[model samples]
Target chain A: MSNAISLRGLEKTYANGHQALRGIDLDIKHGEIFALLGPNGAGKSTLIGAVCGLVKATGGSIHIDGHELPRQYREARAKVGLVPQEMVNEGFESVLSSVRFSRGLFGKPPAPKLLEQILRDLSLWNKRDDATMTLSGGMRRRVMIAKALAHEPQVLFLDEPTAGVDVELRRDMWAMVRRLRDRGVTIVLTTHYLEEAEEMADRVGVISDGRLLLVENKTDLMARLGRRQLRLQLQQPLTQLPADLAGFPVELVDQGRELVLDVARDNQGIADFLRRLAANDIDFKDLHTSESSLEDIFVELLRKPA
Target chain B: MNFYSIHAIFRFEMARSVRTLMQSLAAPVLATALYFVVFGSAIGSRMAEIGSIPYGSFIVPGLTLLAVLTQSVSNAAFGIYMPRYSGAIYEILSAPLSPTEIVFGYVGAAVVKSMVLAAAILITARVFVPYEVAHPFWAFFILLLCAVSFSMLGFIVGLCVDGWDKLEVVPSLVITPLTFLGGSFYSLNMLPPTWQTISLFNPVVYLVDAFRWAFFDVTEFNPMVDVAFLLGFLLVCIVIVGQIFRTGYRLQH
Candidate 1:
């Protein structure tokens, strides 16, 4: 399948000489939930802005569904929607008029039913007649989303869509995103929340210092960089490492009350270590295994120089 | 050109004006009425007629021009500037709108507004001072030309300014002072020879003179020169506005 969006050597340099993006090359597959994970000032917003034609890339080109950007910009932009990070709305405009106006801006014929459905879906139908300024911050954000989706874009870019939202509202947004993905819409989201990426993304791309560090399947990335740890709660405390298990990568924890083992090399390594502990006559009442989360891998990746 | 997009933006801007009727429509009309009361009645009774036209009638064109110029610039400037200030400009910039369509929608609404105010002022002038247009068609042509040109200038100012202070500086300080000095109250011929020659350099003077010629058939420069100057200024504004969109200056990151 062709990519929904494609970028080659995309770069941006601000007038002050700050290089925001340094040659980013990426392809987002159709119908996939792609998450771009980055820290602050990591060029995530700039990358999205370049694709949406809100920022002119200093170098390189972008294509949206085979249409070149800023040239065939009308056609290209018509195929995409952007929910910017900024929570901005027409303060004096009614919710219904705001969304309808946005739909018309794309040169699309008015579809009142579709707009109505969108408002209802976002739980904004009841507030349709109210001015945007009268709504809560979360509600205004919903209005922004409704406006973006009013044109029914094939691809949508959500730049930190859940920023400053409450936990319940964030969950609702996540569910809404899942619904959109199920309907075969391509979604590219940037997030500071690692769990959000881990929970929703089919593929994850890590970027830092204006460079894409890696792009991989979410599970594959976790498995490759993640480490597993075993915690054994011993019935008896020990002060020092046993002389017999000198070759094993194990350390005492909780002031000798538990044996912490780094079991990353192989799955069966845990079984082998357990057998060695049995041979040494070590007693344990309980044990549990823990694996490193995507957050850990993300931090580790950012720590390394590109 | 996407007419639908243009209509959408135009309609949205017009709606805002309706919502802010007190500020957008009433304020200017009331101010123009005061000018007629103070400058047309109180001051006109003591001054002699200028160039075969009543002093009260002569200042009608000037006062109308004053209102239209200032209103056109402030209306168009504020129209575009509000979007930028509120961050709603992102929707416009990201939409499939060609820069021309965006400008047309915005400037078109602003022109409509200035013309409405100009018409109201003209009707109000009839109440305070008697006047008749010698070339009614030319009067309308000059009014429209001035409105379109000044609206374009306002559009440029909207794009160039980054703060509220910068936005107010041009219309309040520069344009207002120039219009007053452009013979909005007195004809340039009444000034000393050197001052009259110097006043000719003020672009607003050409606008006022052309408009006055349309109204009373009296002019300091050829009417065609005035028209050409207005068109020339409009073309320059168009070029600068087009460049702004091309470079994504202030609109894009």
Candidate 2:
């Protein structure tokens, strides 16, 4: 089946001469939660904007369910929804009205029951009649979600959807997102919190400096590129490493208090390395192995030369 | 793109305006009445009537339009600009609503507001001056056209303006001066030939003339000129506003 969303050589350069996106190529599959991770000015927001038709692409093309954007915008936009990082609405409007009106914008007929279900799913049913301005930060974030879901689009873009929201809202939003994915809705999320991506996304894409670094399945990425560290607490604080053990990728850490060895997750032989350490007369009081985390991989990706 | 969505926004915006009915309607009505008291009746006591109409009646069109102009522009400008100002536009941008829907929602509310104020002023003016409607249909038409025309113009101004400091530029610098020199208080016919020619250049003059012609069947200029000028102005406003929405001007950035 075709991907729900696709971008080819997408380039966006603002009028101020600042390039926000540079040739980004990505495909978000149907019924998958895809997370795009990047630092500030990493062009994540710009990419989402281009897909939603909020920001015009200077070059390249974006296809939503095979419909070209900004031209077949009505159809292209009809299939996608966006939950922006910001909280904004008609202050005097009730949460229900805001969501209902949003659905109508996509030419969807009025469906109060659907709106109520969206509100309830987001835990906003009780506050449906309250002016949005009166809502708390977390509640307001949920309202944004309800508004986006009003049209029941096949694809949803959540741009840092939980950036400043509370933990409860964040968890609820993640659950709802999973439900959306289960219902065959493709989700593209951009988040600063790598843990969110690690916990929620099936596939992850990293972007930096207006460039996409990599896109890979979460588990495969961890197994393929992740590293493991074997940290040995030394029995003695003696200084240097043995010259015979120099060939191995290891380091004398904490001023010789510990011996730290880097093991490639998929390729390295930890058994041989342990034997070599024993044969080298290095004694350790205790040892433990730690796997590289998503944060570690993220930091490592950023440290790579542009 | 759909009418229901536009209607939803329209209803919400109108409800918002009505929620502060006292501040929005009463304050402006009182302010206009004060202007008539100070600038119209008080000053006119010493001055002769410019035309067959009394000075009080002469200034009514200008004063009423001034209120309409300011209120209409502020209502729309603030409605759109505030959303952007407070970062609420992002929520709007994220929604399924098209730019055209957004524009119409705002402009529709502005038209509604000016209409409300126009009606109020018409009733309020009776206490100050005994006014008659020579062409009631024409009077209502002029009121709606002016409201819609200025509201559209204001929508563009809101889109173009940036910060609060910049916001002051349009109403204070542009609208106020145009209304003042537009012949609200005095007619261009009262000016010398040279001043009259200069006053003819002011677009507000036609609006006031059109209104005067509708009300008392008396005007310093041809009614056709007023209709032509306003229609031309309305078209210009629509084109500019349409372009702004199409380009996403300040909104996208």
Steric clashes per prediction: 0, 0
Chain B superposition TM-score per model: 0.97, 0.93
Native contacts kept, each candidate: 0.79, 0.42
Model 2: runs farther than 4 Å from truth? A89-92, A234-285, B36-51, B94-99
**Candidate 1: segments with Cα more than 4 A from true spot:** A240-250, A262-281
Candidate 1, residue A18: the lDDT equals 96
CA lDDT, every prediction?
0.91, 0.84
| DockQ, all candidates in order | 0.76, 0.40
Best by TM-score: 1
Compose the digit string of candidate 2's lDDT tens values, residues B25-109: 9999998888778766677677787667888877777788888987888788877787778776664665557767877888998
TM-score of chain A of 2: 0.91
Mind giving the per-residue lDDT tens digits that candidate 1 earns over A1-306? 557999999999988899999999999989999999999999999999999877889998899988888889988999899999998958899999999999988888889999999999999999999999999999999999999999999899999999999987799899989999999999999999999999999999999989999999998998899989999999999989899777878998899999988887466588888998999899999999998989999988888887
